[model samples]
Target: MKFATTVLLTSAIWTTSALAAPRAGFGVPPKAPGDKNGALAAEQSTSADIEYGYNWAGVIHTTPPATGTYTAASATFTVPEPTATDDSSGGKQGASAWVGIDGGTYRNAILQAGVDFYVEGGTKNYDAWYEWYPAYSNDFNLSISAGDIVIVKVVSSSPSQGVAILENESSGQSATQTLSADPSTATLGGQNVEWMVEDYQSGSSDVALVNFNKVKFTGVQAETSDGQKIGTDGATIYDIQQNGDVLTNVTIISDTEFDVSYEAAQ
Candidate 1:
């Protein structure tokens, strides 16, 4: 979740990919091709009806009181299978859908987990993973596919420690792992939880964006440090933007549900 601090200020928008360096940790997975030091591109999207960004085409929680300390966050989403696009840059386009805590106003770190839906070489790939910011995400051994119901949760046992769990409800398989917060980095504030789908980026180059028709998140909830459960009703909608355009519109369906409609901005 670490990127250049300039992104936090909407006025100082920059077009280059905002990828951060990977921090050292256990279970560090190998980098994927085009992945720069474990840094994923900032999400960007486009559409006249929605807002935009570099590769992210989803909603974020950005309104006031939306930022607060939290202990845990969870959500269930249907994995999307986006059609691959032939990028003029000689790469395939794709997106990753995930729910996580932090990375909004509290930008220091993020504790999150979710699934990646991508198309490469005309083939679609779906995989589940969990991440503690500044470190490369670790992939789960469980199998995943488009349309599968997946549940992901990240819970903080303490400010610097937590656990991430991912389950494929349809297949009855799951993965759980312990996550230690980086002491050298900012402590996760547990504020600003989010559910989003982002276009994968490699360094400063934009990866092709996959057409993941539509994706929805249900049972979206979080627990505060004081143990109160917060739902989508308590959150403010944030549209992912690139330059000055809106790419997606986030609709609050209910206190526990929300939907992100892709505007398919090129």
Candidate 2:
């Protein structure tokens, strides 16, 4: 997937994030932060629920032992070494870390993979991606740095078909992306199950945002459909608040483990 013919509609109503419109990372979930144009109503209320979006921030589960749906998902992050954030006037700044399956509440499609960090002026880069969210973002010659140790996963066999995997494990290197047909016809409705730390998009808006200062996710599992294998206590917490500050601060550390840090915004 890589055809930026210009498409912009990253909607993350945070039913745990993304709210469909995919990108779960890339142009990165939009439409929640403050209701850019106004149109979001997911929230079911389990307790957590601290909204704000523009490019996701962390954690977001599905159901509540309320049956099954998700195909599969996994996480194990640690590759933050991005600097330059005063909004990074130096041109570009992005940070991505993913583990997705369905763009949360079936916003069309999304089966992800992760690892991406960039700093323009000072020059810094890294890659290892995979996607199927409204398209765009496909690179995995595999070669990463800066704390490495990643382990992203995604799986789906129906709703269009999918399979994305990325593992850096500090360097052991691993990358796989299989698809039978899941491009523009994207459609994965396993609902939401995400663990992101993203601030992506370089063409239609949202770039400048480095200071990765934080990013953590430990084997946060997910594999439902009936087989059952979920974790994420009572998910629902997304940080990242653009102009209003409130960079991020999500901490769960239970049903699997979670922690997303990086303040500075105010």
Candidate 3:
């Protein structure tokens, strides 16, 4: 499998440099709690609304039909084992699955959390993490493996303060951490919510994407400040693209669920 190095910037307000690297202090991995069942179960939904864009393949809900002080967003999906490719530049190859609030309208900040799957020199690495943009992401100590059912979530009390949670249902391991938005940047709009499978990129270098085949996000739901549970009624879907061509196919399974299939377009 081959992966493209250049990606189209989907957001006009945010530049590639700003979203490229994980900042130094943004993502603080949570301490692993003892293996336990009965973690907070995410709400399950059977329907979802779908729309489509570039560089991102998933669902995005903005304010209009679903508007308010968006407090939290969550999604559950299995970690995919991407097919590794040799990078002529000797870089890693992989992708990330995450759910984040804000970054659609307001460009400067996003409160997000997820897991990463990448290959380096023939070895595949899986790590769970959380990040508040402009700072580097922090990794959790919990063991991660392909096919593990992972549920990730981000919740904000306000625009600047939030907590990220990750749970591996298959392993019974979990991590949680508190974070503040970048102090130097503007506050998060708390307007847009997203569940995405991203081609992991770091510090201006494109990590060779792994062919994860197909990843499906289920049990999707978000909450507004006023306490309204919003579904994917009018959410917009985006496709990750290299140049002007699409690389992934996003299909809405229901009003609150969707699937992303990788095309391995390089």
Best by lDDT: 2
lDDT of 1: 0.62
Task: Sort by lDDT, best first.
Answer: 2, 3, 1
Q: Model 1, stretches more than 4 Å misplaced?
A: 1-68, 86-90, 243-245
Give one digit per residue, the lDDT tens place, for model 3 in 1-266.
11221222333312222232344422222122111111111222344433233346687775633446778999899998867654335557777778988765554677888877877777888878777775556777689899999988899987778899999999999989988866655467777888888774555566656777888999899888878887666676666655434668777877778888988555
Candidate models: Cα lDDT each: 0.62, 0.68, 0.67
lDDT of 2 by residue, 44-136 (tens): 435576665655778777443567688888988888888887656678776677788766545666777777777877888877778776565
Candidate 3 regions off by >4 Å? 1-15, 18-54, 64-67, 85-91, 184-186
lDDT of 1 by residue, 177-211 (tens): 99887655646777577777766454444555566
**Candidate 2: 10-residue stretch with minimal lDDT:** 1-10
Ranking by TM-score: 3, 1, 2
lDDT of 1 at 67: 38
Give the C-alpha lDDT of model 2.
0.68
Candidate 1 matches the true fold with a TM-score of 0.76
| CA RMSD of all predictions | 7.3, 16.5, 10.4
| Top-TM-score structure, candidate number | 3
Superposed on all Cα atoms, model 1 deviates from the true structure by an RMSD in Å of: 7.3
TM-score, model 3 to reference: 0.80
